[model samples]
Target chain A: MSREVILGDIREIMADVFDMDVDDVVVTPDTTADDIEEWDSLSHIRLIVAVERRFKVKFTNAEIERLRRVGDLVALVEAKQPA
Target chain B: MLKSLSWLRPAPGDFRDQARALRSEMRGGRGDDLGMRLYALANHALDENQLVSLARLAAGACDAGAAPAPFSAVKLGVFGDGTLSLIAPAIAGTALRHRLAVDTFVGEFNRAALDALDPSGPVRSAGLDMALIVSDARVLGLDRPAASRAAADETVERAFGQVRRTVEGLRPSIGSAILVQTVAAPLEPLFGSYDRIEPGSPLSMTAAFNRRVADWAADGGVVLVDVAHLAECVGLEAWDDPGQWHAAKLGFAPSLLPVYADVVARAMAAVRGLSRKCLVLDLDNTLWGGVVGDDGLGGIVIGQGSATGEAHLAVQRMALALRARGVVLAVCSKNEEAAARAPFREHPDMLLREDHIAVFQANWTDKAANLRAIAETLNIGVDALVLLDDNPAERMQVRSELPLVGVPELPDDPALFPRMLAAAGYFEAVSVSKEDRARAEMYQANARRAAALSASADVGAYLASLEMACAIGPVSEMTRARVAQLVNKSNQFNLTTRRWSEGELAAAIRDPARHVAQVRLVDRFGDNGVIAVLIADKGPDAWAIDTWLMSCRVLGRRVEEACLAHLAGAARAAGARALIGRYIPSPRNAIVKDHYRNLGFALEDESGGATTWRLDLDRFVAPALEMTVADGFLAPENAAA
Candidate 1:
């Protein structure tokens, strides 16, 4: 329900998708696709899909392509499901 | 796996939440695991609305060219007069259930009618197996039908003629199947006071169009995709989106894509020949009101006199209708054979007799084994059988042991049996010929031959004893339906599995350059009817057999040799140097793998798993047989009758 809670959920979903530990994955506004070892164009799509599925929201193709960092994804998900 | 399996077991709210999650993920991207997502969507947990929404998203993803769905590709072209791209994803979603990765070519809006038909277009170059005509741009806006039946007739006939021309114009390179959607009745509230939304108005015109199309499509490989029926399943209002229509010029609403996709999926499935050929039914409580053996024959309600009896009667009538359309019906019950046979013999209300059944297994054996035996006796694959039993345990047993076999659960009430079976769409046949109607009788003749074979010394002697007669002639109206049905349905003895519809059969019959012959056999046992079909293309110097197929019952009876002998004569008459025949082997039809060689056809060439054989017309000799041949064009069925 809160921003932090939603971010926490996003972390768990990303961990499952990338097969990494939630603790090993760090989130910040500067955390771009370059920051994640496994992140690429294909995996970026998968990550966006994973986040959308976990949060019950949709990201336009333009929005997905323009996403610059994990913080953008977190902010978008929080904005999508406001309390 | 457990998560998907348990997704449907949750309560309403929980199921909704789970379905939403899966659908959202499925739509977001990553077309991988589409098969699983489709499975989850198919579960009963999701309501119709939820399923439709998910299907729409899936269709969108497909439109954008989603991942190659780790599936066997089924290429298709969706062309229409209006916005047709919205439907691509839903079709892709539904095709996933069949394990078909759909690669779609969306025609330019308003050019669906002309795109595939233009011989030099990209659609023709796609090498598609099938194509769908999404909608006619003017169907909804066509002049409303007047009160008179004649007005309605004129409306539909005009539309049908235009559509027919488009269908017939489809180039040979457009692939094998052309799927046309029957125009749906428009949503209520047509503008203008005279445009009264009455049944005999535009609604009647659309319905009449569908009826005529269905009649015309019976023999033609042209399939009428019943989008109107899908519209009926969901409310007509829900199926249409005028807002989007006015805004995007979308001929169809985006919301209805899921339902429309379903219709496309079914049509595609039938075209690919991915359908069952037989329905194995269980007796006891399934076919009658009670257990026949324990309750005695009279106690089992199956007559037209009582309420419960009528329910069982409906199931029997449905079976009889299916049988009439060439869907084989067999009985698999857990009871004594005598007890089962007694009901058919004694009950006056029994719609199905022992003659109607292709196989009757009424032993206490495991039903799974019984179902398999039925399939084996029929020489069809296990995947081509649908078993219906009242007992849940029996359904579960068949489901677990024979997963390939379809086990459709009937409602608790026996009256719903007919409705349930009809809705399952398991026996979705593409075409039915007079031969199809006589299929049960042909199977009976085979049984008689089997009996005679056991009594005779050898197979050759048994064949010789039976006074077999072969009618070799050009295909006639009476025989065209049977010939096309054979071409479409016969896989085991077919040389090259090329399916032809009735329209093509007529075209071939009229073409002088193509020599087509249909063979009908009748022996001592019974009338075998039209059991074989042969089509050959007349080249300048050679006549090549484009298609050669025979009923399994007539195999090993020298039927193919006799046909070839007659073809050689015809070729010689046409001033051709030789007759050509080729064998393209498949999962079935291995019986005829060496048929060309056995018929004295020299191996002309072999390439790419297909073997081509040639027979010099001048030196070819007909196989001697104790039979009579009715040569030349046989009269149509009606004329003969």
Candidate 2:
């Protein structure tokens, strides 16, 4: 899967977790936790769990901790997915 | 209204879609109506994530000051060795399913010991009715490998001492009860398969610790949240998420939070005397493999020799087990009563007999109405009955009509029936006394007495034929737990409906100003153990009836009249001028709205749906009753005789 597709999927999952409309969940490579008011540590963990479930992939503890932006989640999902 | 209710099966639509719709509906000024809808939605089988969403909605409702009635609110103090902030919302949301509204105070993380030990800590100062200490193996240091077998045994002892101190310290400081959780062992084993025998290993140490905690809790009358057993059921590997634990100090996997919250809430419900009492079963496709009306008794599948037959037998065995543990069984089948009776009477493979059922209603009528009749006959609230049916349509109809009645949806396979019913946690009991073992038999005898009452000429002759004998004594240690259970559970017949714990009852019993009576009745049918409990505040002028409650099973037997006669004589002998009584109306206790009035007490005052009554001793007339009475506590002269 392409990075764009992964980011789109992550955006939908984040919308559900944050209880927001998909249109309001606009995300780009530069989007960070600070950009969303509901993206606290708890919701971040929820987001990671939901994203993993959506993509059928697992994230390492290091990868989960190192995630800093929407781009990082997309890159991780892309790397885990089969080419 | 809850249009549909299903538990074991997946809910109708995607939970997110349902939750979002409910959330929007909540914002539309329909908070109270939508709040119950939300509760019904949350009662479905949902995962942790869905539970979190629903919890958010519930928290929002609370913030908006939307109050849901008929759910008793419990003030809870949650102290844990790990991060419990995530669990607080889950518990608040899940408790709604169990008919409880939990107001929580989550203590400082890893500060359970300090919070419990400190006199004015957050937990103690919160004035909580109950406190739950959540922990895993790490809380007791059992996560680490011990040096030697003797050291491991010593570790268990030390852990037990710490727990004992915490519970005892918090008991006196808290409002009512304490709940301690058993630690789940770590999944990773140092000795592999040999961990079972290796005493110093993490697995063995946790096993020893749990055993010690269970025994201690039983002896101390402290309720237990058995996380160790819950973990084992969910599988240790799935239960433990080392990544999340290291990240946020989560006790277990976040995925299991819904299940964990449910277990804890049910334990709280059991301690609060909110557990259900009856298991109302259906006939076709539920108790047996085939419909008895259509297939006949010979063609129906039950008992051994085949998989379907064995599955049906397992359902019967489950019902029998529940019956053995004080859960009354009743049948609500839509068939001819004769047809339903044929199997239980003559089927060779049938395990349950007609004698086992407390109220057998098998006529072709609406199940919701029949369920109401069953609850009436059994003398319990409709909420105390759980309907186990295989038809989804019938389950939905009952849910819409009588939402209080518990209906657990069955899976398509009959083999999973017992497991589904067990998972519902309807009959979650805290303690089982000898009285509990004989409760089903007592209820059956009550049915027989009812039959005999109808057969007799009049109420006088019925009482005469009963040959009833009564014994009343002080509330002693032997009767404390049962009395407390009745005090908390008896809703319809209770006058004051005051829920007093065993400790409170003990203190009351020791007080010079209080007279506590534990009444037991015996008739030709069987032993009705401790059917009535009365607590009166003694005064020089008059004795005030503080708590007066009776088992509804003994209603219409003139037992209440016998009790009043005994109390009147005891009070007069104690130099009291008169007796005072109060009637407080509850949703379920309208049956006793005119209780004091019917007993010939003059109404003194009325306010806020409660009325006070006074009866002068000089004018009191003790009516002649058929039963013989003995009052050894208040009338000590009778004891000496």
Which of the numbered candidates is closest to the native, going by highest lDDT? 2
lDDT by residue (tens digit), candidate 2, B1-641: 01111254464466767777887776775555665676677677665566677767766565423246546667787776567777877787788788777777887534665676778776667777888877777767788888998899998887777776666667765666788889888888797999998999999998999998889677646888888888887788878889888888888877677788888888888876678988999988888888999998897888899899999889999999999989899999999899999999999889999989999999978999999998877667798899999999999899988888889878888998998788777888777878998988987887778778778999989998999988888876777878888887787899988878787888998999898888889999998988999999999999999999998888888889988987898899899999999998765688888888898999999999999999998998999888988878756665411
Candidate 1 TM-score over all chains jointly = 0.74
Candidate 1 residue-wise lDDT, A1-83, digit = tens: 77678777777656544535567779655677687776664345446645766788876655665678777888888888846
- Residue B580 error, candidate 1, Å: 2.8
Clashing pairs in 1: B59-B89, B59-B90, B219-B502
Chain B TM-score for each model?
A: 0.78, 0.91
Error of 2 at B116 (Å): 5.1
Deviating ranges (above 4 Å) for candidate 2: A1-9, A20-29, B1-7, B11-35, B56-67, B109-121, B452-465, B583-590, B602-612, B634-641
lDDT of 1 by residue, B1-641 (tens): 11121112222454444545655675686556554454434533232234334444445445334333323456787766655544665576556544355666777534544665677877667776677876542553443545676765666677877777666555465656788877667766454444444445775567677777788766474787877776666667756656555545555545445446655776677766666778898999878889888998878888877888888888899988888877888899999999988888888899889888888999999999998888767656787898888888998788668766777766688887777776656776566556667766666567557667779998778888988988887777777776766687687889998877677789987998898888888898778887788899999799999999988777678887778777887788778999889999765677888888988889989887899998887787676776776666434342221
